[model samples]
Each structure stands twice: as structure tokens, then as C-alpha cells.
Target: MTSLSPTTRTTLGRKRNRAASDRETLYAVLDEALICHLGVVHDGTPLVLPTGYGRDGDTLYLHGSTGAASLRTAAGELDVCVTVTLVDGIVYCRSLNNHSMNYRSAVIFGRARALTGRDEKMHGLRVLTDHLAPGSWEHSRGVNAKEFAAVSVLALDLSEASVKLRAEGPDDEPEDVAADAAWAGVLPIRTVFGEPEPSADLPSTWSVPEHVRTRVSEAAAQ
Candidate 1:
């Protein structure tokens, strides 16, 4: 397994045991999570917002509109941070303090570059599209000039990143465990895509496409 070289920003000071030290773990977290929160400092104010993201090898792409102030500010000289988290289960413990969650999370810190060139922008868009809506790029029409002009894409290199995972049950005090205070266990949380529901405007006769079927299957298998 390839290990990660932790930088000062990527280093985990608290909950050290929960930190993952492998690059593969980071990749796994990013691949399984669909949404990421983008954190940026704009106009001296810290702004963190939920956004859609896609990864291309070591580069992470964030999606936003050209008119968004956050994206515009992030494209400047300041650095940005992106985080992805997947909740696997809820941990119920004997005490309220011991109650926790089982989760896999990744934090990325880097300066993002705005893709401007036509080829680079298209490639970034394709990667973003393929990750969120699998096979959609090939199944649907390409982006036109007007549509392309309205969207903004940011690419942040994955040189500085950290992955943390918590998979076990709750950790209760010895006294609490001995007393058998209450029911203590984990409620496994599984996220499986349900049957695809078509829009009301669409005819009921329309069948689910092959790409959507594959996506649903892949999501369940994960």
C-alpha cells in the first residue's frame, strides 16, 4: 500500500488514532463520496458551502457558476480547502458522551487553478460529469459555447490531503461498560440508490437507461 506524506496542514493533531496514513484510503473516501464542502476565505470572511466535486487522478474539480462570488474569490491567490465525508453508521453507547459515529472523511488543502483554456475546461467538465453522472457525457449532448461560458471549474492538486476513518463501535468508559448502562451497539447505515423515478413530464412508458441502471448497481455494490 502506498503511504501518504503528511504535511503540516494535512496532519491530524486530534483523534490521532482515527487518522488514515495511506493514499489508497484517501482515494477510496473521495471515490465513494458524492458531495464535498468547499471552504474558502473571501473578503476576509470564511465561507464554507456544499458543492459537487469530481476527481481526476490527483486533481480534484469543484463545480460552481461563473457568477458565484465564492468561486470568483477562490480562483484568486488565496488557498482553498475541500472536505468529503461518508457516514457508515451511528454508534450508540452507554453514555451520552460516548455516543459517536462511524465515518470516512477526507480533507484536501491546496491552491486551486481555474481552468480557462477550451481543451482543459472541456476535460475538466468531462471528468466532473463522468464522476457525478456516470456515462452521461457519452450518452448526452456535449456542452455548447453558451453553456460552457456560464459554468466555472476549479482544479486543486491533491498534493496535500488527509483521510480519516472511524469504523468500529462506540467507546464507553470501563465503569459504564461494566454497569451495562444501556444498549450499546452500532446501527449500520447503508446508502443504496432506490428505483429510478422519472419526472412527471416524462411518459410512464419510458424505461430506465443502461447508464442509470449501471450507476444504481454500482452504488448499491459500494
Candidate 2:
């Protein structure tokens, strides 16, 4: 994998206090995230939409209906932003103002262009499907030309991007710490997998696939 060099535009913050300058840290956060918020300007108005994305090397791929207004507007656009955030914990402080949540977020800015050609579209679709469910691509039916034509794919280059992370506990003043009237600590947050539900039409002998079973196991282990 090609490492992304941290540039002034890719720096974490203005003060660089909460910025995560390491390329590995940023890539890990993006890889672990499932959804991202896409920001675009339509007719001089700002709009943010939450959608699913997949990363391939230095580019991110987003898929949606060709008829969708937002996707249509974003195609061939020079101005766009994508953000992904993962909340890790809740910090409780003696004072309300000192309380803050621990989180990791990434912001990407670049031009987006619609992807054409059957080979690229098929590859994009596979990346998206596998990102959501690892090992699912081989198990499920591949996308046909008709289904591929109905969808639109936008590729965003990762030339300008930054990651910001806050993981410390609450910051309380000395006076507030002495008061100790309110609890001050961190409440860890996490994502978990529930029991798998089988489809109603499935045969009784059909068992859960290894991919899903492994996912549940890995989540539990984490």
C-alpha cells in the first residue's frame, strides 16, 4: 500500500492539537467505519447526505441510483467533502462545559467523477459489497449488466484528507475536580452483533455461513 504523506491541507486541525498525523491511524479509522457523510453543494446550497462507501487504495467509491439527484449533481463536480466519524466513548465531567465525547473522524476533499465502463463498474460494485460483508462477494450472485447500468458510481481521489481524534477523558478545572459532586470518568462505547436471524423462506437445514459466524465471533472477541 502506498503511504499518504501528511500535507498542510491534510493536517488534522488548525492548532494541530487533536490532529492524528499518522497515515496508518487515519487509514485504520476509515477502514473500520461502515458509513460516511457526503457533503455537496447544489445550486449554491449546502447539502450533507449519509451513505455507504468503499476504499480502494487512494480512492473511495460511492454507489447510488443514477436517477438520484444528489449523486447526479456530484458527478463531475470539483467540490465535495466526505466525512466519517466513530464515537468511542462518553466522558463525564464535573462541569457541563468540560464534558466531551471521544471520537475519531476523517474529512476528505476532492473532485468526484462518475465511473464509466463495465469492468470498472463491476469492480466498484464488488468493493462496495465486500466492504459491508466480508467474504459475501463469492457467496452471492454477481451483479449483472442490467443491474450495473441502473446504479451510478462516483470515485473520489484521496489527495486531500485529514483525520481528527479525541480519546482522552473529561478535562475539568482544579476547582471542579476538588468539588467532586459529579462523577468524572469515561463510559466506553462499542458496536456489537446480535443473534443472526434466518430468512423465513430458507430451508430448515440451511445453516449460517462461515463469513457471518466469523464476523460475530470477531466482534465478540473485540
Q: Pick the candidate with the highest lDDT.
A: 1
Q: Write model 1 residue lDDT over 4-92, tens digit each, in one string.
A: 76677776574878888888899889988888988888678888888788888889887865323354653353378889999999999
TM-scores for all predictions = 0.90, 0.89
lDDT of each: 0.83, 0.78
Superposed by TM-score, candidate 1 places the C-alpha of residue 118 at a distance from the truth, in angstroms, of 1.4
Writing each residue's lDDT as its tens digit, candidate 2 over 113-172 gives: 777877887788777887888888989887776877778777788777877888998899
The regions of model 2 sitting more than 4 angstroms off are: 1-15, 66-75
lDDT of residue 9 for candidate 2: 61
Query: Which candidate wins on TM-score?
Result: 1
What alpha-carbon RMSD in Å does predicted model 2 have with respect to the real structure?
2.6
Q: Model 1: what TM-score? A: 0.90
